[model samples]
Target chain A: DAGITQSPRHKVTETGTPVTLRCHQTENHRYMYWYRQDPGHGLRLIHYSYGVKDTDKGEVSDGYSVSRSKTEDFLLTLESATSSQTSVYFCAIRDSGRGGELFFGEGSRLTVL
Target chain B: GQQVMQIPQYQHVQEGEDFTTYCNSSTTLSNIQWYKQRPGGHPVFLIQLVKSGEVKKQKRLTFQFGEAKKNSSLHITATQTTDVGTYFCAGGPTGAQKLVFGQGTRLTINP
Candidate 1:
């Protein structure tokens, strides 16, 4: 296990509400990524951070935003939740020393009603 | 945009049977990585193939990268209940910083 932790392991919120999921890591990795997993879609990248205050949008960035102010914390926010946004979100840290292998956290299951 | 496609959305096999999944990328990949996710669990790294036409094996599991660097495959021998899960292939495009994942192939084993 790679010292990664995701807050709010499970959440259920009504549509149109704002939600933020947090990912914290202790490995001091340089790369952190956020991914959402859905049936038939595998794991789709949402956003990623290469360093403090350095972030990039992923393929599925619509309706979602992210921030990383510190090396150990990454945050993903859903501006306005929707039913389509319901999925399991995973936070990962890239271990460049290990051929850039990604070690993921336990994951956060979010439900939008 | 780079895309990775996987075949057989779902597969069911009896214990001791063989199973295989294929992965194809729309663009040539600098590297291909495989991950396995058990039901209700997060994806875990399995292996990565960086060289073209590379083949690697892990016990009863075998992994291969195409000569063109645009495809890969994972083959499991003597499937067991422990192998039931979804297998995903992610492709890192040449000079790209992000990896694109395939839809994945879900495996179910009947003991």
Candidate 2:
């Protein structure tokens, strides 16, 4: 198993509030991703970083922002929480190593009222 | 943006039965990957298929990529009670940095 951990394991915030989720990896992988999972929607990418200060937007990137100032930590923030943004957020990492397996963090469940 | 369509939305089978789900991409994909998420668990990597017409297997599960590189399938034999979860297929284009996951197929196994 890969060493990945997510902070704020669970959170509940009211609408229009700002929330930030943290993702930390012990392996120092070069690639990191943020995704959201909702019922019947599978997982949708929110943002990803290939290296420190190198980030890209994903399909559902609106209303969210990400920053990776270091190799082991990635941060995602929701500017103003909304009911539609309530979902389980996951942090995943993959690098050119050990047969191309993508490891995931336990995930953070967020609920916006 | 890339998209994948997976089906059937949900499936239920008795232990020892067979199960299968498919993923179809709207455009040609450079590679396809599979993931499984147990109840209340995060999505875990299952396998990745990078070549057209490629096939790979692990224990009772088999994965296949279509020759056109726009579709894939996963079949599980002799389903067990532990086979309950959602299976997702993700695809990425060549030189693409992010992966797009399908809607996923939820599986339920009965004893």
Candidate 3:
């Protein structure tokens, strides 16, 4: 929780609706990632950004879109929410090393009806 | 598809017992990190292993990276009730920012 805060920590939305989750970090870390965890599936990456406006797809990016317009802000959008999209989403920032540890924000729990 | 697999999906032991979790990556990892997540809590960073055949210790926790650099392990000696949580291992591939995580090993201590 150090510098990472996720907005709308808990959400309930209807299927086919558009929803966006916001992640803001005060640490100004260059690497930010969005991961969704479901029961028994561990944490699957949805999207990640290495720099402003530089984003890439993760393992499960089919229904998720991410935008990083600023250093501290990363937004993940579900173009159209679905029941299967319901899960706990976490925002993480990487430490500066060849490949360092991640500091995670409190996760966002989303429920799609 | 890089696979990071963790062994002993669940571990239950008496207080003061030792515990260990193993993580193996299908591909060689640039580095590996271990995290501990309490029930209903986000993961907290525990340690990072960068060099092959490297071993580090923190209090009762010992972390090691295999000489092949494709596997790692976390061993806790004389565990306590406070150590109840899920232990996760994440691996980062060379030139990649994504830290793909293993399924995690949940540890339970019987007090």
What is each candidate's DockQ, to 2 decimals? 0.87, 0.84, 0.87
**TM-score list, all predictions:** 0.98, 0.96, 0.96
lDDT of 2 by residue, B1-111 (tens): 577999999999999999999999999998999999999998899999998999999999999999999999999999998889999999888877678889999999989
Off by over 4 Å in 3: A97-99
User: Candidates' lDDT values, in order?
Assistant: 0.94, 0.93, 0.93
- Candidate 3 interface CA RMSD, Å: 0.7
User: lDDT tens digits, residues B38-108, model 1?
Assistant: 98888899999999899999999999999999999999999989999999999887666678999999999
On lDDT, the stronger of 1 and 3 is 1
Q: For model 3, which pairs clash?
A: none
Which residue runs of candidate 2 sit more than 4 Å off their true CA positions?
A: A97-100
Question: Predictions ranked by TM-score, top down?
Answer: 1, 2, 3
Candidate 3's displacement at residue A49, Å, is: 0.4
| Per-residue C-alpha lDDT of model 3 across residues B17-101, encoded as one tens digit per residue | 9999999999999989999999999999998888999999999999999998999999999999999999999997877678889
lDDT of 2 at A36: 93
Worst 10 residues of 2 chain B by lDDT: B91-100
Whose DockQ is greatest here?
3
* Candidate 2: tens digits of C-alpha lDDT, residues A1-113: 78899999999999999999999999989999999998888898999999999999888999999999999999999999999999999999988565455788999999999
